[model samples]
Target: MYSFKSRIRYSEVNERKTLDLSSVINYFQDCSTFHSEDTGNGIDYLTSQNRVWLLNSWQIIVYRYPVLFETIKVSTNPYSFKSMFGYRNFMIQDENDAVCVVADSKWIYLNSDTLRPVRVAESDIASYGLGEKIPMDYKQGNIILPEQRVSKEPFPVVPANIDTNHHVNNGQYIKMAENYLPDQFSIRQMRAEYRSAATLGDVIYPEVALTDTSCTVCLASENKKPYAIIEFIS
Candidate 1:
């Protein structure tokens, strides 16, 4: 497993002074990139080869949200790889070694030049020493929306929303969904399914369904086809 230690910055916390979902997502994102770089398969190497990694899905469970200035250890490792897809697990632990968050993510290797997924070299996979064990045994399940939503908000993708991929970053989707949630609700767990990419100038309609303990948010087009579906459990 590849590991790193860091403190929760004040800017990364919400009004409650606790880590937010978006920041949690960012931690996992950064740690994976760090791991790749440490193993000699970093972004520079991939870019040189005209390839990139794209997130496919995320399922994260938060047992406790760390507060500002709290030190935490973040770690990740590849658990499975097949064809063009890779499966990895991440965890955030407190100073006392108690787990604060656990996550499982799916990713696809893409040929940047062709914008299509390509098989990852077996030798590359061997270097990571991929294992069969999955942390938290977290499964990203299907998110079923209610027949009728409680609210809807429409917004355009701005230039700032675009990432290196020239599309909206995956973490932005989680932030968007969190914004639509009630202020009293705290996300204990979240699952996001990225169906399609949204680019600058594209307008997305976010529809939300609320329950006593959960909220389901779908980022869709005006015609109702979805780009992403996110579920938050309090």
Candidate 2:
């Protein structure tokens, strides 16, 4: 496991002065990226080899949101690698050593040039050996969507949404989905399934479904094919 200590920044918190769910997701994302870089298999190497690891899905549970300026520790562990798929677990712990947030993620290793799944190399596994899986009620497969939903206005993907991969950043999707959430909805758990990449100039038509306990948002193309599906459970 790779671990790092940090203090909650004012920019990372919500109006309540507590860390928001989207920022929590960003921490995990950054931790994993740091893990890759420290392991000598980072973006530069991936790009050199014409390879990229695309996020497949995410399952994050927030036990409590840390307040601004609170000291915390963020960590990530790569627990499994099967063929083209890689699994990882991430956590954020308070100064007291209590876990405040935990996440499970799936990734697909692909040939960047072809954008097709490929087997992970032996060198890749050797650098980042698998660790024990984190304890959680692991939910596999796609987040189930409700049959009925309402469509929102379509928006164009701007450069700000693009990352080094030249596509929408994984966390940005969650940020987008959060806008459709009901006010004051305290999210305890969130899950997302990434179906395809959305690049600059692409328009996203958001479809939202809501219930007393949950909200589901599908960010899709004009044809109604989903780019990603995000679910939040309060």
Best by lDDT: 2
Residues 1-234, model 1: lDDT tens digits: 888999999899999999988999999999999998888888898899899989999989999999999999998989989899999999999999999999998999899988899998986666677756555756646778788796565999998778888889999988888888897898988999988889998899988888899999999877878889999999
What TM-score does candidate 1 get on C-alpha atoms? 0.94
RMSD of each: 1.5, 0.7
TM-score of each: 0.94, 0.98
Candidate 1 lDDT at 27 equals 94
Model 1 lDDT, full chain set: 0.88
Error of 1 at 115 (Å): 2.0
The ten-residue window of minimal lDDT in model 1 covers: 131-140
C-alpha lDDT of residue 19 in model 2: 100
Off by over 4 Å in 2: none
Evaluated with TM-score, which candidate comes out highest? 2
